[model samples]
Target chain A: MILNGVEIRDSFAEAFPMVGTRLIITADTAKWAMIAAKTVTGFATSVIGCGCEGGVEREIPESETPDGRPGVSVLFFTMDLKGLQTVVPNRIGQCVLTSPTSACYAGMEGGAKVSIGKALRYFGDGWQIAKNVDGRRIWRVPVMEGEFVCDHDTGSVSGVGGGNILILGASRAETLAAAEVAVEAMQKVEGCILPFPGGIVRSGSKVGSRYKGMFASSNNAYCPTLRAQTETKLTPEVASVQEIVIDGVSFEAVSACTRAGIEALVALGRDKGVVAIDAGNYGGNLGPFHFKLREIMA
Target chain B: MSGFVLTPRRAFETRVDLAGVLPGVDLSGLTVGYGDRGVALAELFEIGGSVGDRLTLKSGSALLDRVGAGLSSGELVVEGDVGDHLGQSAAGGSITVSGSAGAYAAAELSGGRIEIAGDVGERLGAARDGSRRGMSGGVVVVGGSAGPRAAERLRGGVIVVKGDAAEGAATDLIAGTLAVGGALKGKAGRGMKRGTLLLRSADGLAPGFGDALEHDLVMLRVLARRSPDLAAFLGGAFKVRRFAGDLNAGGKGEALVVPAA
Candidate 1:
């Protein structure tokens, strides 16, 4: 399939199962809320090394939040339920508890719960107070700034990770620009995150490597430097390749985000140094969720 | 599902215990103990309706005590004034009392909701005999005034009094929230241990409370969000003067007094 003369590959983007949780961090002002949110979502770009993948889902107005303050919603994804349990509390305690005038609450409910405030109440020593609000327990830990309130626990749901879009451009600059616009488009879609630096990955990899100790290595087929030496998938005209990786709470979110990224590139036009739009797959062995490019665009 | 339309047979000489008569009584299965004798409920009241999770009682001259005591689940509607121990030990379900309720209303309740359209007597949502923790779970919304010792020994849950509260309100509170819309009698929050008492009058705060500071607490916002009845009472004023108190009890509890507009 082609849109504005850009090739839309017929293959699908593969995604694996994960456990996800959503949390809301509210503060006296938008600045402090963002500070706490960025701190908690920091260093969490990939399950490959960071142990979790997360990003700011959206900014909530004071009228919409539970605490009548500016808030930001964040979504975190881990490869296993146990990982979610360990990461949620550790990140919240280290980031939110330390931020001034910040309070955390569960963004969603009804699933496996991980301790967010139930575990952090220890910081209060013996003065931590627990109150039941609309059937949900919330803990208020006394702090220098009066108090830091948080929900007892947060619920987790099944998620999908590793949904990607491969952008091949005629030059390095062109490839990076296209990937940048694609990432921006994906960020607009809720429940999904492009978990890479600047939301773009240049060193896209395949499962396993020649080195016995390494689990994954670079995709030689898409590399411009090795185009002639290796079994190249790119034509001679293609000079650079970049990928936009996405992790989402559901299959529909992943598909919607993929469609948005592809539409953005199509809108950018092929004359802008674009070559092709494709996806990475491991022979459909790694993940259960599959999003075919043509079908998603259709 | 049809519910029971219960009407008292005759004005009795003494009070009647109407506890545990919810969620599962039929036309023939209904029974109540009056003083010394076991009276068949069908013989006393006109019990007619499809049996379901609803129970409606129409009272007469006789006072009905413990109307919804120990109610675990279902819906209950009381038509007239009820005696003491209303909804005592209630775990789940909703109870709506159209008229006034006697002392110890909702005492020792663990879960569910109790809404009273009229005034409530003393010890509202307080602990019963032998139990240290009282009203551990659930919400109690009183449309009118509340008597003394409201929310005494409360372990958890929310209690909102739309009108004035008598003396000793929130006394001996063990964590919970008591928001009074009108004037609070003296000595409120005495011996409190980790609890919040919101008073609209801002008077009657004891000397034990120190460190009085004015600020908008996030918990108040949450309370206003969860209970519309409270939000209406709080109006637009979000600022509150917080007095950390009951110093004799370690000084952890707080009394948030809303200033006059």
Candidate 2:
């Protein structure tokens, strides 16, 4: 589909099933809340190496939070519920609990739960107090800085990961600028997150590798440096490619984010050094969820 | 919430115990006590109204005790004053009193919610005579002052008194939170083992309680958010003076008294 002078490739982005959960990390101020959000979401770009993928979904107002403090809502995704149960408590204990004047709560109310405060309450060393608020149980651990209050557990939801769209252009700078704006637009969709740094990934990977130990390697077909030697998916005019990977609590959320990102990049058109839009897939064999670029934009 | 309506036929000649009479069940076949004799409920008041999820006492009386005792489900609404042991051992459902309630309002309460619009008599949410656990699960909100030994032997749950509390408030609190809005008189939290007492004014506390430094406890904010009934006591940032004790029992319990506005 060609519109606004940009080509929308017919290819689809493949996504795998995952277990996700949302958490509200609140602090004394908005800055600290954002800091806590950033800390827990760091080093979490892909589940391949980091064991999870996470990003800040949005900033929550004081009136909406459990403790009436400024908060940042974050979405974390792991390959399975067991992995999510293990990784969530560790991240919350090491990041949110250590932050100054910070408290954590469950952002979503549905589905099964994983222990957050229930896992870290022992840090109080017999000083911890548990209170049931409304219907959910919460723990108050007396810390040096007053106390660290957190929900007993957070709900775990079914999610989709590795939903991506690749933006190819003539130059690295324009492609990057387009990718940046696309990320900014896609993040506006709730229940989803762009797990990569700045919501943009330059090294999009394909399954399998030449090295026996490595599970994944770079997408050589989309690489400009190897275009002459490898079977290229790009034309001669295509120079740089940047990918936006989305992880969301559902298929509809990932599709909405994909549509939003493509619309932002398409708004710039080819005159803005944009060449085309494409996606990565493994012949529809690896993951169950599929988002066709043209069908989504259509 | 339209359910059975029970109105008094005449002034009670003697005290009446109307416990465990909830709207969720068949009231026509039920029997209750009048003075020293057992009588059918229909003889005391007209049992007229649809059987649903609400039980409304058209007018509560001072002689009517245990109005909603052991209510397991449904809503019980009282339009006037009630006698002692108001919601004893209520495991579920909600009881709302539009007028004052007598002593032992919520003794041995394990679950559910109780909201009183006026004053409550002594030993509110306290342990029963033979039991050590008081108000183990659930919430009791009193819009007016409480009598002596309020929240005594509280093991869990929450109790918020919006008005002044007489002597010995939270006297033997074991756990949970109790926020008293007005002045607290005499030996509060004296034998507390683990619990939080948010009081506005506290004087003549026992020597077992030691004054701890002031702190902006997160529990205050948590209670403020979860229980809106305590908004009058916590409308702004609540920087409180912490008194840790009763050391004779265990030093874990804390009484956070907010400096008077």
Candidate 3:
């Protein structure tokens, strides 16, 4: 299928099951809230080495936030519950707890609850006080800035990860620009995160590596430099390819991200050098959620 | 008047308890014991409404005590002034009184919401008789003034007094929130262990209380959203000057005074 004169591959984006939790971080101002949110989600681009994938889901207005302060909602995802439990508390305690004029609240409700404040309250060193308000337990930990109020626990739900879109462009700069637009659009999709660096991954991977110790390696088929040496997936006209990986709280969120990313690129038109939009999948062997690129872009 | 309307037929000198009668049932055969006399509800009250969970009492008698005592559920609306022990030991559902509620209103309330649109007598939302804790759960909102010792020994839940409160509010409060939208008389939060007393006006901090700096508390925003009546009183105040007091006690309790901005 073709959308806006750009080719839409029939392949689907394969996504694996993940565990995720959302956190609402509020501060006296939107800037500080974003600082805290960015800090909490920092270094969390991919699970390959970062242990988790996280990003700022959206900005929350003061009226909607628990503390009546400007806030940001962040989503953190890991491979398992154990990994999620370990990463969430550590990230929130170190990042949000340390931020100025910041408070943390659970963004999602009703799931497998993992303690955030219940565990971080010990940082107050016996001075932390637990307050039960409106049936929600909150911990007021005295910090140098004043007090950091954190909700007792945050819930983790089953999530979808590794939903991807492949952008094949004629030039490196054009492909990078198109990926930037795609990421910008995907960022607006709710309950999802583009977990690659700058939301663009240059070195897309296959299932296994040439070496024995590695589980994944570079996708040589999409490499322009090795197009002559191997049976390449790219055409002679395609010079650069980049992939945008997404992780979200649900399959709908992943699909939303994919659709938005493709639409944004399509809106840029063919003259922008984005020739084709495809998706990544391990031949239906990876996951149950299959987001078809043609259907999404169509 | 169209629903269940219970009007007093005679001046009941005896303390009448309307605890068991519920709406949506045939009340013609219903009877409640008043003092030492087993009074048939049909003789005392002109029951007129159809079957439902809502029971409205018109021309409420001040002599009617324990109007909804030990009420576990259902809605009981009183049109006129009611005597003491209204909604005592109330566990669930709601009770709205258009007129004044007497002493011990919603005392020992474990669950549910009680809204008194008019003044309430002494010890509103306070501990029940011979009990250590008051209002272990639930919410109480008084549109008018509240008597002295409001929320005394309150262990949990929230109590919002939209109007002025008499002296000794929040005295010995164990936990929970008590907010006074209007003037609070002297000695509020006296000997309190823990809890928050949000006041709109602060004549002066009662003795033994230390002045704390004006700080921004996000939890208040959460509270504001939860209780619209209390939010109306707050007028959207996210920052408040705190006065931690009852030093004679644990000094954990706080009186958050919102300065007019």
User: Backbone collision count in every prediction?
Assistant: 0, 0, 4
Q: lDDT for model 1, please.
A: 0.86
Model 2, B54-112: lDDT tens per residue? 99998798889999999988999999999999999998899999999999999989889
Error of 3 at A91 (Å): 0.4
Report the error of model 1 at residue A261, Å.
Answer: 1.9
Point out where model 1 deviates above 4 Å.
A207-217, B59-62
For model 2, the superposed segments whose C-alpha errors exceed 4 Å read none
Question: How far off is residue B127 in model 1, in Å?
Answer: 1.5
Q: Which pairs of residues collide in model 3?
A: B3-B49, B4-B49, B24-B51, B24-B52
* Chain B TM-score of predicted candidate 2 relative to the true chain B: 0.95
Q: Who wins the TM-score comparison?
A: 2
Better of 1 and 2 by DockQ: 2
Residue A81, candidate 1: alpha-carbon lDDT: 92
Candidate 1's residue-wise lDDT over B23-96, tens digit each? 65565665787777777777667776768889888773227888889988889988877888899989999999
Candidate 3 wrongly placed segments (more than 4 Å) = B24-26, B182-186, B201-206
Candidate 1 docks at the CAPRI level of: medium
C-alpha TM-score for every candidate: 0.91, 0.95, 0.94
